[model samples]
Target: MDNSNSNSNSNNSHEGCYFNRLLEYTSDSVEFYPSFKNSTLFTAGTYQIEQGDTEYKERRKGRLYLFDIEKDNKVKELQSIDFNSGILDMKWTHHNNISQQYENDAPLLGVVMSRGELNVYRLNAADQEQGERRLELVCRNDVSLDPSILTLSLDWRTDNKEIVTSYSDGSLALFDVDGGAVTNRWIAHDYEAWICAYNYHNTSMVFSGGDDCKFKVWDTRTIEAEDGGRSNSSGATPIFTKRCDMGVTSIHCHPALENIVAVGSYDECVRIWDLRSMKQPLTQTDSLGGGVWRIKWSPSDNNHLVTACMGGGFHTLSSEDGTFTDLSIKSSYQGPHQSIAYGVDWSYTNSSSTDKQQYIGCCSFYDRCLSVWTP
Candidate 1:
């Protein structure tokens, strides 16, 4: 939603998107659905402009901003979609009873890009109408198998079919969101795998993180179909792997606690691993000064969790019932989020609001900030 100039009033339909735009670049990701009354936001961003000669490409295309979280929290922008490349992460997928999905389907938006596409948009929003909203385009799904890779992160597999992608080189793809298929492709990580997840309490269990400091676990069933799953140079060898303390980016798998994971690194700590009895970190968090790209868990509150921390900013982790024993760290209104704190989300309201109430939606990067922190 940037470079301003798209909405004439309403009525775009969805072809190349570009409707109701206005979000001017660099604010990497933020997602929250929480709407029965108040919450539905998506914010994505990217930029680069060079053109001609070497081309310098970084902004092939990107713009997805749809906000409306007003309940006194206030966000209200409401419409923009413009996709094609350079977005790098976005997930919403609905039908909450707790997301085993399928109440009839309806809401879905799972994107990842830079050029290695894997899209799926279609926000029925209870059958449109408000400003004649539109995002439509159910599947693009390329997943970049051969070489030209770029898709950074994704994770949807609660029953929304499947999606678990993360790649820059150091691959790991498995998408099949309604058969726009890429079934499985692998490499697992020796370099930039950023993050990959799907273990909303065991969706066959898969999780990864890396710039090559490793923290892995994969067993889609032990993935081995040979070439139909495609490109598997010995793909399934991580029923376990761990060596953190630096480059492990972020990973979150703890919807209602079953293996309970929450890792983040670049050495700025925040581990909470318990994957079948941990190897270390049952709790850790000392330096939240930077480097923890994102880790969010609390769609309905298991104990509460959220963190962005890129230049060290958004933080909140509480522990009690799910029992990590005693863990508490809170820095929610950090001076007003200066920069780098990539993205964060956790706002599914039923509104009993207490236990120090926290409702968040954040985004930042090179000062393209977007925030809404309700208490």
Candidate 2:
């Protein structure tokens, strides 16, 4: 396949808008699980191969790579770590006083394993002068749930001490980092809770979506009754609930815009909602042509968002108008032809002041590829 391709819809209002690929990386047989923190990129994946006619075996071992963008606008691999399990998700916490103690130390990284374990790692900046520094495992915690349940998604609080996770068993849990224990756990949905997120402006509240085809909001304070007994009856009731045509696949609260959120569903539409009034969506886009697996709001631009469509490839949606409109940037890989776009994130660093150009990093599942571009 050609490494780069460009095409645009003639009917698209913004026909001149095009996405230029800045970096492309492909793995031989392993898939890439990619995440970004500022200018640095991290990826991990497992290797698998067929053993015989009907049996297959996984190497179990996984590899993690770190890439940093240089002054000349080139990305270079800075470090690699070997792990015993495949990585499902990775997040970097906000820079806080605790993380600022060490000079040149990278932000704390939270790693979610495919087998239901959460590990925190930090870059060892103390020995950079001596030799190549590596990541040090600072803390590890196992989310105690049904053995069959896998942690599907997680979000860190801005304070950097707590993390909220969603599980395959349709449950949500809050974990305390210092205490190394689950602070709270509740059943949030009837089926797999695919996504859970913290409202950045209001940390006490959380939002989650699941295969049950519902988007719900929860308040942590209501976990226990006034008498101190667990409130099993009313505790599970969400502050608000909205049903979609298909399973809700992803949910993201706007980073800067409070009360505004972007919700994606298996129905191939991304709906923008205002928390104040949920009777109807503020605006809904036309069919995006695939299950929207991930939605990321650009840190640089408030009106822009990027979607990882499982079947339609990648798309950039802008809300500068009253409603969200598709920019129709060029995408080389559409689903069913190669693989589904599973992971997508926007880089926080933006050098341009006039033009709203920021780096976007995306990874495809079965294609085992990662690409960075600007739309």
Candidate 3:
């Protein structure tokens, strides 16, 4: 059987591409769902960018606008939330099993404000009559060691009832919505914690990275309760910790594999580690120039990973060895004019169908745009 011919035919039916411009021209964020050919792109400040709304009114000045991308590259206004502070990061939770309880409800959208307040917003179309969406304060905790919350990450737990956040002050906290409290908190590192990712394959595992020149792993199951604590000789309580050498910029747990992690660092390399052995990385490679700012493992395949470098271009690395293939985004009306690549996501298409082909989605720093690439 001609596998190439078979693969090509399958991809053609599933693969689609489009772009949504952020309402604000700043370094904003974008997420896409290609099967729906719909996307959400928002910027810090906001105005309104509707068709023929105003000739040249700035839509990204007051509110963070969320627009939905339709079939014809047309963006529809979905919802808008005004913030006294700018928006940091936003993630939509996938309703794997939680949708059963809500019945006819939209997935929850988690947002981290510039002031370091993490808020969870449940999209409820059931109450269109209220004309007002409810903004539930899931859990609010101030993580200000220097009066600045550099970055925050929010990932849903396996139970989908709780979320994990990594603060700038080198702290990791897990918030339970049902309990209305932070169930666990640990000072996993000594510097700014830039990223935190929960391994869905291994629900009890949490991975974090930061400016402390280390990427540490913490087992959520080993979290110390309010009273069950014992201190070491130095009076430091033992926490489930494993450290890397350089300041870690980004981290992702292998989607399908258990306990395997990909950590990108300021050392311009990506390190793959195993939680079972904490001595050293299982594999390491210097594919990213300047520094590997962001790295992501393919959700569809555990052996494939992607990296975004600081000043250099992006690279697709093999999980077998640390070898990588460089990818260049075309500057044609879309991108590569952007300075650095910051965020990357994978879009799996034709879920109900048998096709398994998926494309990588990326957004960069300077020129605010989104690009999709496939092997």
Candidate 4:
């Protein structure tokens, strides 16, 4: 597909390094552990909260902090740095995003930014803020894999030592954590490749969605280095490509289904595709009003799917037949309705032995707010 018809947003440019929406806060910002047993929400952007026995919060200026939420909802201030690099996405590790070699020591989580920089930091156990636990840079690609990338997704291979990241630049690259280099790179789409995921049930499978309005299923096993690895430097060749309509920003696999995948797009639609029929989506659901940015499959249930959109709203969809119902918490605070929901994660935090409901962690862009929703 030719990108000639694409309209460019200046704020999306990496060279300018200007974020259009900035959240300004007044007064000394108070940090709350949203995961705490007593708190209902956790807010952290300008300040760092270390929740534990001491319960202390350290404030920072001009730095974005990465906080690790424990099972108890306690937030551990993980990493803090001065750079205002727009972190597009981050993935937590079962072992770590970095390597098993460091598992015995400090495991690392991978953070991808809009500036095309990737960083891996050793997660340190903290009771409080000690001098500086600076994040270690395993690899930094000064230039983006896709120059015009609007979104990113990082998923570790079944082995956990390898990570594959998809970009809006219409490309997908697989990196070996130990080698600290990209093992495979494929031009997956014509427009922005928004989101990507690995089929955890099947190790060799992967998927990506983007502005081209297509969701593609790929078999890494058939994909080999394009130059036959004869020159030993040319990247891998994509073995398969499929197309679906409307610029997709999010793509995820059905937690229990083998060949089923779902994608969300700019056309305000969510589509599900089967590998057997790739030309058109098998199922499609319209977004009530907003452009959906992220779609996630519930880790706890195979039939439940969740999505967050740009208009400060979210929805829960039934995977049984692609039917969706609106789901957002009632805000008593009556705060800003412009909170663009950028990130969402499902947690089994408060589940009891007999109860099966899962909690969700959502991050808002405009307000820099993180909210926990129980459903």
For all candidates in order, the CA lDDT equals 0.69, 0.63, 0.53, 0.52
Worst 10 residues of 3 by lDDT: 1-10
After superposition, the stretches of candidate 3 with alpha carbons farther than 4 Å from their true spots are 1-17, 20-25, 32-69, 72-77, 94-106, 124-147, 225-245, 320-334, 350-359, 370-375
lDDT tens string, model 4, 1-375? 222311221132222111112233211111222121222222233322223563121221224454443343234444545543455666644321211223253444566655455666553444465632344555565325433343366766656677778766677777667777676677777767777778755778887776777666778876665432212223444444555456777777665566666677776677766766666666666543567787766654555667776673666666443332223322211122246655665553234323343455555664655444454
CA deviation > 4 Å runs, candidate 4: 1-79, 94-108, 126-151, 226-242, 276-282, 319-336, 350-357
User: Candidate 4, TM-score vs. the true structure?
Assistant: 0.65
Candidate 3 yields a Cα-based lDDT of 0.53
Q: Residue 345's C-alpha lDDT in candidate 3?
A: 56
TM agreement with the true structure for every prediction: 0.31, 0.76, 0.68, 0.65
Q: If candidate 2 were superposed on the true structure by all CA atoms, what would the RMSD be? A: 7.4
Q: What is model 4's C-alpha RMSD? A: 12.5
Pairs with backbone N, CA or C atoms under 3 Å apart (clashes), candidate 3: 45-60, 46-60, 46-61, 46-62, 47-59, 47-60, 48-59, 213-246, 213-247
Instruction: Compose the digit string of candidate 1's lDDT tens values, residues 57-119.
Output: 343666677665434333456566665456878886643244332334456778787778877
Q: Which candidate achieves the best TM-score against the true structure? A: 2
Scored against the true structure, residue 88 in model 3 reaches a CA lDDT of: 48
Q: Which residue pairs in model 1 clash with each other?
A: 1-23, 1-63, 1-64
